[model samples]
Target: MTASRFPRWVYTEGGEPDPRFTLANERTFLAWIRTALALIAGGVALEALSLPIQPGLRLVASILLLVLGLVSPLLAWFGWAASERALRCGRPLPSSRLGLLLAVGVAAVGVLVLVGVLVGPVGR
Candidate 1:
C-alpha cells in the first residue's frame, strides 16, 4: 500500500491521494452544513418572535427568514462545488462572489427594515 502524491480522483478519472485534502473537503462541507443550520435557526427564531408580533409583520418576517434559510444552503452547496473544482484544477481560489452577494443581500434587508420602521407608524 502506498499513499499518492496529489489529491486523487480529482486529477484522474479514478485515483486516490493523500487523505488531507479529503479531510479538508469534509471540513468545508461541515462548515456549509453549519451555515445552513444557522440560517434555519434564524428563520425559526424569527417565526417564534412572531408569536407576540402583529400578524402582518410577523408573516412578512417569517417568510423572509424562511427564504433566507432555504437559500443559504443552496448557495453554500454551489459555492462549495465551485471551490472544490478550483482546488482540483489548482487554480487560485475563486473570488468571494458568494460572500459579497450574501453581504449585499443582508444589507439590503437591513435597509428595507429601516425603511419599514421609518415609514410605518411610530412605536406604541
Candidate 2:
C-alpha cells in the first residue's frame, strides 16, 4: 500500500484532536520506525559477522531480533492509532503495552546473544 494510503484507519474515527497531540503521536511513530530499523540492522550485522559464532544459536538470536524489529512498526501503528482514536472519542488514552513487550523482547535477545558469545562456537 502507498504511504499515503497507509494509516487510513486514522481518518475513519471521530473528529480531529488537538494538533499538538497529533504531532506528538506522529513523532512517536517515527521514533518507533527508527528503532525498528536499528534492530533490523543489528540483527543483520549479527548474522553477517565473521566472528566466531555457533550457527544455530546465532541464527536463533538473529531471527529473534529480526522478528522483533519487523513486529515493532506494526505495534507502533496500532498503538498510535488506538491513542488517536481514544483522543478523538474523548476516552482515556490506552496504556503503553508495546513498550513492555519490546523491553522483554530486547532482554531476551540480549540473553540469547550473551549465551551465544559465552558458549556457542566461534568463527565460521
Candidate 3:
C-alpha cells in the first residue's frame, strides 16, 4: 500500500495547478467514478434478471462487468493523479491506458451479451 504503487495516494507533492484545471480534473475523475457505478449497477441488474442464458454464461458476463466496474475507479484515480502531476510540472500529460481498457472491455461485454441473445433469450 505504498504511495509509489498508487500515485493518487500522495496528493500534495506537486505545485498547485490552476484552480480551473484542478477543478476540471476533479470533475473528470467524478465522471469516471459515475461510469464505474453504472457498470456495477448493470452487472447487478443482469445477474438479478438471471437471464435465461446458461448459468455459466450469465455468471461470467456478470463477473466480467463487475470486475471492470471495480477497476474503473482505480483507473480514474490514477489518471487524475498523473494529469495533476503533469499540470503542476508543466510536462506532457501521461498517456491513458485506462481509455483503451474501457473501450476493449466494453466491446467484450457487448460480444458476451450478443452471444447470449443469439443463443435465445430463454436459452437452449
Candidate 4:
C-alpha cells in the first residue's frame, strides 16, 4: 500500500505519481511467457514433423523448450521484483543478460538441427 512498494509515478501525468511502471513490468512478463510458449510449440512441431530426431539431439531441443517454459515465470517474477525495487529506490532497472543468452542458445539449437538433417539418414 506504500508508495515505496510500487512505481505509481511512472504512469501518471507529468510523472507526478502513478502505477504505470508496475503495469509495464507486468506486460513485459506476459510477453516473456508468450515467447516461452512459442518455443515450446516449435519444439513440438520439430517432434511432429519426424525430423531426424536422434535421441540426443531431440532431447536437447525438448529440454531447451522445457527449461525455457519453466524459467519464464520465474524470470517474470524476478523482473517484477527488480522493477519494484528500482521504482522505490529511484534507480535504474537491472540489466538483463539472459535475453542475449537465450537468443544465442536457441540459434545454436537451430543450427544443430540443420546439421543433423543434412548429415542424417536420407531414406527414413
Off by over 4 Å in 2: 1-8, 120-124
| Over 4 Å off, model 4 | 2-17, 52-55, 122-124
Model 2: per-residue Cα lDDT at residue 77: 87
Show the colliding residue pairs in model 1: none
Give lDDT tens digits, candidate 3, residues 9-119: 445566657889879988989999998998899889888995666555667778888999999999898898888888877788888758889888878877887787677
Ten contiguous residues with the weakest lDDT in model 2: 1-10
Q: Which one wins by TM-score: 2 or 3?
A: 2
Alpha-carbon lDDT, every model: 0.57, 0.83, 0.80, 0.67
Question: In candidate 1, what are the lDDT values of residues 20-110, reduced to their tens digit?
Answer: 7646765876776676577677657755752444445544655665666677677766665555666656665566445665566556555
Better of 3 and 4 by TM-score: 3
Global fold similarity of model 2 (TM-score): 0.85
TM-score of 3: 0.83
Give the per-residue lDDT digits (tens) of candidate 4, residues 1-124: 3445344453331323247876786788788878778877877776667666465676677677667767766776676666666765677889753587578768877876776666674545
Estimate candidate 3's alpha-carbon lDDT, on a 0 to 1 scale.
0.80
Give the lDDT ranking, best first. Answer: 2, 3, 4, 1
Candidate 2 backbone overlaps, count? 3
TM per candidate comes to 0.60, 0.85, 0.83, 0.73
Which candidate should be chosen as best, given lDDT against the real structure? 2
